[model samples]
Target: MGVDRSMWKMNPERLQEHLQLKNRARQIPDKKKESKKRACRVSRRALPLFPSLSV
Candidate 1:
């Protein structure tokens, strides 16, 4: 369902805030994937220094 027009008419600022939040929510996943990849690379690099850690 679409957002109700009356809601925006009642509080225009709420509509702006909702749209901003929606946009930010869309950007979060890509950042999470990049961070996970970086963590994996760091762990892989460290594993060679402590060979016992590798399985």
Candidate 2:
């Protein structure tokens, strides 16, 4: 089904901008996953020091 013209006011630039924002939204989760992996790596490396520091 085709979208209604009134929805975007026939503005092609608005449609392109909306598409670009959608693409950026899709990339955000991948960046979050990468940062999470880095955090997990840091925590694993620090795990050994915890027990010694606690005693």
Candidate 3:
């Protein structure tokens, strides 16, 4: 089987740009995780404010 030459048309610089964008997308959840940790830490003090609903 012959290799496809069409896939190699991308410029090296463009490939690097795409890779950097993908890496930044991967790091987004990490920031959210840190915020969630802070929220959980503060939530304990606020939990009692919401009264439990009886069915």
User: Lowest lDDT 10-mer window, candidate 2?
Assistant: 1-10
lDDT of 2: 0.79
- On residues 1-55, what C-alpha lDDT tens digit does candidate 1 reach at each position? 7966665564678878877887898877787788999999998887667667765
TM-score of each: 0.37, 0.37, 0.38
* Window of ten residues with lowest summed lDDT in model 3: 46-55
Q: How would you encode candidate 2's per-residue C-alpha lDDT over 1-55 as one tens digit per residue?
A: 6765564674788878887886898777787789999999998998886687888
Q: Which portions of model 2 miss their true places by more than 4 Å?
A: 1-10, 30-55
Ranking by lDDT: 2, 1, 3
Two-way TM-score contest, 2 vs 3, winner: 3
Model 2: clashing residue pairs?
none
lDDT of each: 0.79, 0.79, 0.76
- The root-mean-square deviation over C-alpha atoms between each candidate and the true structure, in angstroms, is 7.2, 7.3, 8.3
